[model samples]
Target: MRNFMSKKLLILSEVFHPENFVINDLAMHWAEEGCECEVLTRVPSYPAGMPLKGYRNRIYQKTHSFGLPVHRVGIVSGYQRNLVRKMLNYMNFCFLTTMMLLFRGNRYDRIFVYQTGPLTVALAAVISRMLYRQKVIIWSQDLWPDTVFAYGFRKTRLRMVMLNVFVKWIYKRCDIIMVSSEGFIDKIRKMVPGSEVIYVPNWPDINCKRVGIKSLPEGFNFTFAGNVGKVQNLRNVLAGFALFAEKNHPNAWLNIIGDGSNLKALKSLVEEKKIPNVNFTGFRPPNEMPSYFAASDVLVISLNDAPLFELIVPLKFHSYLTASRPIYAIVNGEVTRLVKRYSLGVSADPSDIESISGGFERLYYASQTELKNYSANAAGMTRNGYSKEKNIAMITSILWPSEIGLKQADLHRAM
Candidate 1:
């Protein structure tokens, strides 16, 4: 810990900031909390299947984002799951990052590993522990071995069983665990029943001057943000909106932000239906997210018949909570639970048009007084608990547990 005035944290995450999502939010949050965070991350190319333009040829690079120094590892760029290519991408990252860190002229106190591709990154953590006796904190974003099957990844049964064994073995070696949602805690508890899994729900910079709330233009407008992934039941969302739009065309507009594989199909569906009220405005900057939601009287989130998503909370949900508008969440699991608990939103079944129609009506006709109450409550929830500051402190507490004497001796040596 030589001259390391702040806690020296090594974050091994598959994703990082400026890719524009909650992983970035957490990374930025960690950097702001007086912790000297060094992230070993893959180049920005998730969902897009292409590396960010400037970084296409980069290998072993360092850059600053949100005041955090990010160390980038060059992984195989063609990251799709075409068997050999996918294996190469994951392997190269694990090998390169592990080697880079060993040679990089710094001593990190404790290493925090974010699990999305748990196997490849777990190898890095295991090697780190073996090489340096480093403290390994597995802050799992998703539980693997089981999740491979959940995401419907292609693999032989025997291979999956072996993978599961390896992933669980890595979990057992971790010094601590932090999960992003309440639902993850429940699911992981069922697996490692007595294991330690702390809840550190996703946070964004909620205090950096939120967008002013605007009134719906004497008509109902709805919006949905986040990935256009397989699990996002836009089929049902578009269907419900069409029924309302057919009757009250200009009175309603459905604005979608974010992009994904399902985008082209969704656009064609809108054209075919002549759904005049629906509009697609691709990705927007995180700071610009406020007006996008504020312009709408209500925000919507949708999920399909996947038990895995139920156990996972998408970061977009937090953005909706930050929007300071009512959310008509078509979701199951913890998101709906949060929506109801916060008294900030209402929910309907994702597949049920009748229920969604009913929710649209309530939002469309809601009095100014009622909307005021919801906005105030949503802002209060964000300010009182879910700001970036709160999450940073929570994670720091988890890292330096000795600060509270939760561990014997000085774990400062680990730092």
Candidate 2:
């Protein structure tokens, strides 16, 4: 960008890391691009109720390992399934953030917020604009009431009426709205035609998997990593893996490596069903993720074919694709479309054991020639299509469009 003056940017999110979440990386990327970024977020406690080993809940300040200043906002230290409790958790984050911002700190040039918990963050943005006349860039990967409804808050007439009105208000409130995938952009456009819906795909820990591949184990070892929340349909995945193993398939294994609110129920189901060929490796550290991914033969990502998730294009997609392994996305819509467009992986039905079984069956025995081509395409997606450098450049252009004065060549060069 031509303009080099310092611009203060504040990012608000509940899942910033050393906890290893998407917003953490996104903020860090912005910092590297020379934006003066500060993150105001909850003291990290996710997946499990306990705070990450060294991180305690405090009204204190600390710097990320990367040296970006982080301002801690209070939040309920739980991930309960009770809708009321979940709402409380979300409210705890939002209200605390809003209150925290009100009484503290210098005014920022712009505000950026990550969506996951409450609509209150939108309220935070509105208040920021009201109190400081600040501009906001909202990264909304999922819609609010639609998600609340998915989590079984089936709306009554009055509740639905209020939420719909609230949503339209936020569309106008946000200066920039970004979604994680192209499918989401289309859906948002239909609702808020004049609002901007930029497609900002999440970046991966690309430093990993930059080397040559290793020899596979005697059997193909597949992995499903990340949160097994309501959005993810993992029950059918277990059943499907069992079906593959039942065929006495000489070379097949499944590893489920992560914990979430549903862990107890999912684990109990695994025991009750005696599902063979499946193993659950409870949560591991962020740095451990890269090596874990590198060891896998293929990566599996499952989300219910809910239209909301169709547009999501989870951040994990980048990690899996970057690892240069074939992916089996038990998902449809944009993710499936991208996988097919790039000839990257196989697709399977989310809730059907048969489709999952068949998908693994075909991939497990793929000819070396075909498998190599798929691997190449997945790797190429990172180097030539969605590099972090490219994403950061695009974000910079969006932020300082006049300064960049970019031509068509600069845009395509990013790809």
lDDT of each: 0.71, 0.74
Per-residue accuracy of model 2 over 172-226 as CA lDDT, tens digit each: 7888787766766666677678886677777784357334433334567898889
Q: Which stretches of model 2 miss by more than 4 angstroms?
A: 1-3, 29-34, 59-65, 80-82, 104-106, 205-218, 403-415
Assess candidate 1 and give its TM-score to the true structure.
Answer: 0.84
The Cα error of candidate 2 at residue 373, in Å, is: 1.5
lDDT of 1 at 303: 84
Q: lDDT for model 1, please.
A: 0.71
Q: Write the per-residue lDDT of candidate 1 for residues 1-415, one digit (tens) a residue.
A: 1232256778888777656545665566665656677888878887575687777547778887878788887767666535477778878887888787677525776788877655568677767676777788876767666567665677798877787677666766677767776677765666565667777777653233546643334566788877786678898888877776666557677878878877888999999977777778876555667766777777888888567667777777666767788778887777788778888777887768877767776777779888777777777887876777667655656676665554522332322
**TM-score for all predictions?**
0.84, 0.89
Q: Judged by lDDT, which candidate is best?
A: 2
Candidate 2 positional error at 211, Å? 12
